[model samples]
Target: MKTNKLILIFCLIFSVHSFAQPKMEEKKEQIRALKVGFITNELKLTADEATKFWPLYNAYDDKQFELRHQKMKAFKGRMEADLDKMSEKEAAALLAQMESNEDELYQIRKKFVTSLKGILPSVKIIKLKKAEDDFNKKLLEQYRNKGPRR
Candidate 1:
């Protein structure tokens, strides 16, 4: 009887812990959508710009997406593992990878901005930068208000 009670307790605890953790794929999708929102707001793109921008944007996004996946693939299952348990070396390595990924993103943005400038007005370029900043600020506010993922 005591053994059965212990098993039940264990199962209950496991169930609660599982429910408490946010699913990785769900978080990825949410972030992806948020990024899309930023892109839209930042561009404040007109109908004509939208027609031109989207195709190019899609290509750029795809490239960035590939880079992210490539970086993540390097770490494999270790990302899901507990951060607290990671060794200093592991953590440092991860940070370096993150920095490299960030640099790549910056380069991609620079290239795309040049592309946009060729087809867009200087005024629109300023608006696009402002829009991007505003979108990021909003996302930060929302995330902070909501607290950490469940």
Candidate 2:
């Protein structure tokens, strides 16, 4: 009887996890749609400009996301370790990894902006940066205001 109960509980938990995965993906898609709309409005991109711009922007965004995901994965592992007990060499290595990640991110941004110059005006590129910042701030504010999740 106990074995059956354990198996039933496991199946229930697994089913709920499977269901939740789709919801999480749906949420990501919603946010991506919102970001696309926000950026399109802010840039006021001409149809021709948008045709050229989106491909470049999407590529850059993907690269940035990939790098950030890698960095976060590594950081998460380090975080699980006992920080106070970490050796000096490990601490130094962590700092070096962080600085290298920051530098790589900066280089990526520089390359992206340089590429943008061909498709967009300098002023519009500057506006794009500000628009990105504004969008992030607004999203964060909304998330904070939403209160605790279940």
Best by TM-score: 2
Superposition TM-score, candidate 1 onto the true structure: 0.52
Query: What's the TM-score of every candidate structure?
Result: 0.52, 0.82
Show where candidate 1 strays beyond 4 Å: 1-43, 65-103
Estimate every model's Cα lDDT from 0 to 1: 0.70, 0.79
Candidate 2, 7-109: lDDT as tens digits? 4455445543443454776666556556666777777877788899989998998899889997769887997899999999999999889889989999999
Count of clashing pairs, candidate 2: 0
RMSD (CA, angstroms), candidate 2: 13.5
* Model 2's TM-score against the true structure: 0.82
lDDT tens per residue, model 1, 1-150: 343344445544554454355887665555555555455545555667778877876788788788878776877677878988999998998888888888998999899888988778888777776866776687677669767764
User: Model 1: C-alpha RMSD to truth?
Assistant: 15.5
